[model samples]
Target: MLIYSILFPILAIIAIIVFFFRFRSGKLSLSSFFIWSIIWIFVIIFSIFPDSSMVFARVFGITRGLDFIIITAVVLLFYLGVKLYYKLDKLEDDVNKIVKEVAISNEISLDDEEEK
Candidate 1:
């Protein structure tokens, strides 16, 4: 067993525990928790059985396991990046809407005719 085989699983386990607590505390959404869990679980699997990637690579028609892993990582990253970008845009819009509503509700009257 390589050093990484033991080390990566340990780190992955720690991350899973930390995220589980965060999810329980309502800091993470169900989907977010599950996504992170899946990612970490894959890390643990791959670290423990490095040869398993070759099977996955064969399925994907990739000649090398490392290439397959890299491609998958890039694709996953792009997907996640797009997801986060959309969420950020939605949050920005929500904040702007709330601010506008608050401003309108708390409007100040400075008209001279109205003050008279």
Candidate 2:
């Protein structure tokens, strides 16, 4: 009950903020709300379940729910880190391509000037 009381309001606030931002940007979509609602529902259900932590630990083969939560969080963070790294790599490649094109054009212009 305590967990639900703390988490439900936080999730609700997050959903509201996300919806507000999307609406303000004129890109509001149903899918985002749907996902958020699903997550909130799952969290609420999990919070209500007695021995939820023990269930999670048994399912995950972890000693405790806290350990399972820590492991899940670490995995999520690593995944995000890898995703951001790839995005940055792609951006760097794009910038390098543009720089190379500009350099080539500048060199050609210099040659033309020298010829004249």
Candidate 3:
């Protein structure tokens, strides 16, 4: 009957399809799959019952449901961004450590061959 009524289900279905494809293709990790599934389920629930957001906003002293959603989304995105950055940095450090070890080992073996 309404735009959201039509849009929400479409978006939810698309997200589910993407999730399945990514998971099956090994592009998405198990933890990420569960996290995204929960996020999509919440999106569907909020889209279907927007009035709940209003109640939530009132409780939090926010003026509108849309504003509450926007603020929450922004904060969540920022947090996830910081988390991913740290994870990538740690991975890079690990790779560098492994590479350094391999290089040192090869250098030692080369020296031994020269000594022989």
| Most accurate candidate by lDDT | 1
- Whole-model lDDT for model 2 versus the true structure? 0.74
Give a tens-digit lDDT track for model 2, residues 40-110. 55555455663575677788789877676568668867987997999999999999999999999999999
Q: Which stretches of candidate 1 lie above 4 Å from their native place?
A: 108-116
44-107 per-residue lDDT for model 3 (tens digits): 8788887888887898999999999999899989999999999999999999999999999999
- Per-residue alpha-carbon lDDT of model 1 for 1-116, expressed as tens digits? 89999999999999999999999999999999999999999889989998888999999999988788899999999999999999999999999999998876666543544678
Taking all chains together, each candidate's TM-score versus the true structure is: 0.85, 0.63, 0.77
The true-structure Cα RMSD of candidate 1 reads: 2.3
Between prediction 1 and prediction 3, the one with superior TM-score is 1
Per-candidate clashes come to 0, 0, 0
What candidate 2 gets wrong by more than 4 Å, as runs, is: 1-4, 15-51
Deviation from native of the Cα of residue 12 in model 1, angstroms: 0.4
Ranking by TM-score: 1, 3, 2
